[model samples]
Target: MGGSTPTFGFPRELRILSSREYRHVFDSACFKVHGKGLLALACPNDVGHVRVGLVFSKKNARRAVDRNLLKRLTRESIRLQQHRLPAVDIVVLSRRGVLELDRQTLARQLHGMWRRLEKDVKRAADAKTSA
Candidate 1:
């Protein structure tokens, strides 16, 4: 164990716990990225790293298995891409037809959304610097 590998773990600090945190993002999201059946709303955070929350309602997923699958996919995607994301609190919402999508499709959609968010954050930063 001479060389250490970089870890990409989803710790509690990387999660958006509590209804109040979710509400804050829903109410004041500065960036929004929409995908096939997923939407990611994000707002800048002072914690200096990205945080994620999932909102997969029963009306959308319909079954506990389906909901858990969606959460797993979403969380895996976030864990892999968290290093590239800006310091923001992100809430990912699933639409009614999300379960219809295959796992690969859903993963691709999430990846695209994360890329869009990164671009948006960069654009905002450039604007602020130029101003």
Candidate 2:
């Protein structure tokens, strides 16, 4: 994590509640994309900042540790990219193949996902505004 907190992080009191929202970030919450392994839910924080959620399931990663590690990877990646994204909630789904990815590859993929998501969000906003 940066010396400064990423633009989006759940407040200490809200992290658990955020995960309980159930809606996927892409479909429900506003979002931006990064790489294959990384997806984010973006919603304006109450103070107009971003918040994040990480999802890793045993069905996808197999082991509890693997799932936990995947969540950790997602957290790190988002923390690194948080400054560039707007306020929104993000939920990263862990595909089965994610366990096969090395750390560096995962990080790279996360960055790419973020770039794609930014473009998608902008395009959607533009479309909505134009409509």
Candidate 3:
């Protein structure tokens, strides 16, 4: 476990309800990369802070307990790498394998996904600046 409390965690930080704010992101969000257990979607938001929407659908991960656990692990991974990410709303969609993966595997998968997203975000930002 991390020594310091993680800033990007559930109840305290994640956003998951269906609303107009979410719809705004849904239409604009672009998906960058996907791995066995995860898919990352990025959307530019008007808010100053980055918001996360984590989904572990019942159709994929059956048990509520298992789904919650996977969400928590993904949350921690994001919290640790929060500094490297851009200021965009990120949604991580979870798969069944996510529940079974080891901590290292989970971290590595998420980190790789984050890295991909960062690259795309930066490239787009640069294109806008150059244009």
Candidate 4:
């Protein structure tokens, strides 16, 4: 390589790794952003950056390919939008209709969800500060 290249890698530190971590977010979700075929629950974390967990259950997507595709899209969306997100652990759950959506539609939906999530977090912060 001639010049230094930008690394667009999704590192392990940015993932909600263990069952305990997932349970914490589930039990005490600070906020949720709903989108077509998906629901994202998030709780504030002290990690100083956003971390993501994806739940594409077999009940929702019967095919392994469909589940994997959704997971990849979710992870890529999070990686791109991480800097704009608050310090929170987010778990994105897929619904039954998710597999019906085409890739582009799904990507757009994920993008919108991230935008909504950012807005919601900012609003909460503002409310906290004003109180």
Top model number, lDDT: 1
Cα TM-score per model: 0.95, 0.72, 0.80, 0.93
Candidate with the larger lDDT of 1 and 2: 1
Q: Write down the lDDT that model 3 would get.
A: 0.74
Per-residue CA lDDT of candidate 4, range 1-131, in tens? 75565445689989999999999999999899988899999999999999999999999999899899999999999888887789999999998689889989999999999899889999999999999
Candidate 3, position 75, lDDT: 80
Model 3: per-residue lDDT, tens digit, 47-109? 555567777899778989878877877888777777677778887787657667777898789
State in Å the error of residue 37, model 2: 4.9
lDDT sort, best first:
1, 4, 3, 2
1-131, model 2: which lDDT tens digit per residue? 67764355535433424545545444466654545644555644454444566667777788898888787777777676766765555666776578788988987888788777767767777899999
Q: After superposition, how far is residue 108 of candidate 4 from its true place, in Å?
A: 0.7
Better TM-score candidate (3, 4): 4
- List lDDT for all candidates, in order: 0.94, 0.65, 0.74, 0.92
In candidate 1, which residue pairs get closer than 3 Å at backbone N, Cα or C atoms, i.e. clash?
A: none
If both were scored by TM-score, which would come out higher, candidate 1 or candidate 3? 1
Look at candidate 4 and give me any clashing residue pairs: none
